[model samples]
Target: MQKIAFQNELTISTVQQRNGANNTKKDVRKIQSWLTLFAMTNAGAATATGIDGDFGKATEQAVKNFQKAKGIPQNGIVDQATFDLLAAPMRAAFLSTITGTDLRGLVVSAARQHVLNRPFELVISQQPNSGPWVRAYMDGNEGREWLWCMGFVQTILDQAASVVGKDFKQLMPLTYSCDVVGTTGLQTGVLFRYNQIRLNPALMKPGDIFLLQKTPNDWVHAGLITHIGDDFIETIEGNTNDGGSNNGNAVLSRVRNFRKSKLDVFSIEGLV
Candidate 1:
């Protein structure tokens, strides 16, 4: 597969992270971050002590445990091969090139690839919304204050749009707030409210953004619409888990019923 050129603040170099190796703080931190995210999804796997920029005994043991779980050599050393495995999920998602001329097709492909990669947020040192994935999508900002649902949506949109020389920031500002995106969509005549979309289902299309309406004027969360049916829409959302809460962790694929959920549509009809 051709690797798309995507660079983020957390991009790790090819340097190996192993005990007694002269590991830079940047490299060690990336290793710990990968280990942390890996443990969050896998059950009972050993997690790094914390992303403290250290490859201490605990981090080594965690690497060994991760190696064991992966059925690789339990050498407790992060060699080039081991680092490749550790960073596969993130590298695969960011590097994937979705080849197409259709903008909506590109958007759906980008969003689906992210869900397939499983960008799960990590709560390191009791801090919520702080992780490698969160930083990547949120433009190097991560913490409890940075709710990344809209950030994730924008990142995917930006990725898809960039391929065709279209900028999503023009449709809506590059913002992390759902209110900004929702209000911008409304002001620009691109937003279809729940009531309007319920009547005109054709207005909603794959790759259009879905805003979870809090009130008639307020949207609490945002996601990418991947499929639209008679009664439901399949969504790939960020900062949400299996329960579908706006504040939950991870990017998840969810089936949301239009009849039950107050989801407004932000159409990207003319953007392409």
Candidate 2:
């Protein structure tokens, strides 16, 4: 895909507008959409900020909040430095502050530690959250009724962060809906879903997340990519097992063949 730069010619006069000023110019409209994209990508600005090209308080406040996050003066102005930050990739921003001797191993190692739980049945009584060993995976995310694969993945991420006494939310946001993560990744330009590319298994690394895209916008299942082999991917997935059922009932390690399955792999190269 060709990289399209966000407008570099965004002048202060081009984006600035008083509370009662008219923002009908085409340039102003482009800047408003650009700002909205920037704010959403950076993760602090509210998504409700309408990209209507109206430089009202909402847009002003959104830009100001973004400026504050970037440690720029809160003058509600989009200067050159601030505009450059807007053009920066979200994946880089998310991982820019992450520090460790080996950042990639943290999550994969944390997930590998939980590879031995049992009885992955699809029935309600024997789900992934049923076992005392894996119950903690669902601690804050799910009640007893939860199936727990997504919870397991979420827990492992946070647990890895805890090993270094750092918060995991800085690396990845907490979410139950795999589709939302997929959607947000696409929207924020942080990740690209592997489809036609049939991404080579060697190209992937640990800490990446894989989504089972059952439909165009629907992601049915997800897991942590612990290791990759010549033809298969070794994954530690919740609510599943060696049987490969997406709705199974335990935290299990499974090897899935990339060439045979319709899985979409998303890289977290600089996102963890």
Candidate 3:
């Protein structure tokens, strides 16, 4: 087994400590510079060029040049991979920080918050059937005509992944059982019968993918698990029915103690 590097751990701890500190802009800039230095060292770039976090002309040029060489969009910003290259230790640190902080709740909470701000459209066109565009429009002040629950889920997962820096693809699968559809599984008094089996609510930790399955369909909607309470699991969903007038938008809603809901709960734990 590969030994965990102490330097990597230390770097992440330092970043966390700095983030926790209520520093002024100047101090924050200083910390950023230090981060850049750390990234440079790990990347094995020459130290002849001073390590500065300013993202100045030289850094910007370097980033653009690197992007061109790698066939990535030359936007000059250090994206995830570029960031990883510059600061492998920091990436390790970031993952450690999340794991150590018991950040599962944070992830769930963040996802919930994103959902509340929902109805946002996704930039990619491939997921049109997923209803991201409809979700985006719904989240907007003006609602649209069509809404697709599956599309809504995709947008939320995408946003959650960006915030948490984890590949959600690795943690969750886009599959729902066919048997758990409408009114068959659980009964809620005389009212709503359990209908859909979305992303496995049981297997969810912070940042895990939560999905919504339409009746008869295997996999439909998607979201990120932001919070998991004893009884309730809050989600940031998109492209939902918002009453009559403001319908067809992305919105965040809580799936109260999802396990208790009349709906059948299927977890993607083993699948992930």
How well does each candidate superpose onto the true structure, as a TM-score? 0.88, 0.54, 0.34
Global lDDT of model 3: 0.37
* Top candidate by TM-score: 1
Model 3: residues >4 Å from true position, as ranges? Answer: 1-106, 116-148, 162-165, 171-225, 228-231, 242-247, 257-272
- Residue-level lDDT tens digits of model 3 in 16-66: 112235323332232333333433333643212223224355645555554
List the candidates ranked by TM-score, beginning with the highest: 1, 2, 3
TM-score of 1: 0.88
Candidate 2, residue 44: lDDT: 54
The candidate with the higher lDDT, 1 or 3, is: 1
Each model's lDDT comes to 0.83, 0.58, 0.37
TM-score comparison, 1 vs 2, better candidate: 1
lDDT of 2 by residue, 1-272 (tens): 01111122233343365363544444344345456555434555652355455677776777777777777788776554665565344223112343335546877765665553232222212322432223345443333456566666766666566656666555456766678777766766554555542654555677777888888688888898887877778888887755877767566778887777766766666545
Clash number for candidate 1: 0
Q: Evaluated with lDDT, which candidate comes out highest?
A: 1
